[model samples]
Target: MDDLLSGLRMPERVAPGALFLPGYAASIEREALRGIAAICALAPPHHLLTPGGRRLSVAMTGCGAFGWHSDRAGYRYVSRDPVSGRPWPAMPRSWRDLAREAAERAGYPGFEPQSCLVNRYDTGARMGLHRDCDEDDLTSPVVSVSFGVTAAFLFGGAERHDPVRKLAVESGDVLVWGGPSRLAYHGVAPLPRRTHSLTGPLRWNLTFRRVTHRQGP
Candidate 1:
């Protein structure tokens, strides 16, 4: 949002778009406050409907070229933001830099993310396992950065029958998944009742993706 649009840079962590890495973005972590400030400017995290009317406890917002939204109509992304009926705030330069570095570190090159889904978690908020298939393009990998509170990142295989791998993610951690790992069902388990200095009693997750509404390469 307007309040968070400070143009800052974290030259430490920059990468391509395929390989998944963790804890290599300390500079980005320090600059996260700036990014959060910007996200709050556009769409503050608000519990949204799950199409079935179930209220999600986590506050969800977004930045970049498109923002993700879900309602009774189903899940999708568009140029216009549902909240202000204006376009989602442009992805901050900090985000772009980090994603590029993380992607490159993970082995992918030239990763340009157009959508950044911001998920804010309160003490008890949790997200169930779900595959991110709304993007018309499944070939692109997903790059995510964890901030604030610590939690378990559940990374599952393609089939539900396949067990999940729980990875402990603390602040300033980045995860990248593509190729066979891209379609894996991943989610955040409930945050234990805890608080932090920078993040307070919450968890902030920034997931960057390249979404194609109707077509892709």
Candidate 2:
């Protein structure tokens, strides 16, 4: 599926309530990167082991009120950082603003994400097909921002066997999905060994989600 979707193109609505905004984060790239660095400083990224004892290739950390975690116990959200035994770093205003604006542009207005998961993918790292179903509220949309090297995003339907479409996601791309397609399965293909001017040989992904329906202070 290489070159299936050309790089740096106009916004595309690939599915119902799912919109891809290419280079959407270009304006705030520096601030976003800084925010990520701060969050990682507070809660450094770490590889998580799956229930079956397989270690995830991607290193992960998070900011905001909740942090996504997976272990032999199960996949769920925790308010405290497992590493530091403290609350996850607060979500940066820039990060929240970008996420809210992106969600609104994708037709999901008034989105207030309570959690932002930061994932770092190095060469050969790939995520398997799975749905974002751990959130307490499924009605809210998910806003994802991509930075560093380009990646092929796999977007699938509701069923596991459903056909998938590959889309090339470059640095500064923002993807928003919710409503009817809230639980759609998706994953990232293995990243090729390449270097970006800003992030070197790695790719960073920020996924903003409204984990609960409760309002934040």
Candidate 3:
């Protein structure tokens, strides 16, 4: 596995533990897109309102052992989909394999993500800087895959006031961050209005996480 990954080329270390593998997901783009369609069909994505009652621009859904959710109540992981009132669809094998491989290539081996958050961003949609801390196991890394239009990704330090490093993430790119950078504040800048043959004027982001800490529904 190491040899194969090495042949693919070394990944750029964006931070202490954050590695960026450009075009790492290109080979399986078609399969991953199909899996996204299947998962979305089962649990349609929808914009969620925050605890502050502000609606998020990104529409989202999830699949795996748990689904990340936020609402007027709070943010946490739930075993069932808040929309369908059913268990989130099982994680696609292809998706899981890609995530595990990407994580391992980024230096975090033995990563078993139990949750995959699928987020869809339309033109003008943006995610605010925030830390992903709901998961119990901080030891495991978060693997993110981008599809469709390119966007600027902001990676910052532990404090919100810390300077942020902006990086452009293109389709088929994989990013993994864990260990010291697991709780770093990060977010996506507002997407520019544009169209891509594969996704039109939208971008799809898949975030894989191991939600070892399960909360009651």
Q: Which candidate ranks first by lDDT, i.e. highest? A: 2
Q: Tell me the deviation in Å of residue 49 in model 2.
A: 1.0
Could you tell me which 10 consecutive residues in candidate 1 have the lowest summed lDDT? 6-15
| TM per prediction | 0.87, 0.95, 0.92
State model 2's lDDT.
Answer: 0.91
Q: Over the stretch 3-112, how does candidate 3's per-residue lDDT look in tens digits?
A: 58434444788888999898999888778888889999999999998999989999999899899899999999999998989999999888899999999998888888
Candidate ordering by lDDT (highest first): 2, 3, 1
| Tens-digit per-residue lDDT, 1-217, candidate 1 | 5326622322222222323355666667767767787778767778889899888878889888888888888778877678788888888887888887777767666778889989998888888998887876676678888888888878787876678777667788788887667777878889988887887888899998889733442
Output the TM-score of candidate 3: 0.92
Q: Which candidate number has the best TM-score?
A: 2
C-alpha lDDT score of every prediction, in listed order: 0.77, 0.91, 0.90
Candidate 2 ranges beyond 4 A from true positions: 1-8, 215-217
Give per-residue CA lDDT, model 2, range 1-217, as digits (tens): 3345454478999888899999999888878888888888889999998988899999999999999998999899999998899999999988899999999999988899999999999999999999999998898999989999999999988999999989888899999999988999999999999999889999999999998886643
Candidate 2 matches the true fold with a TM-score of: 0.95
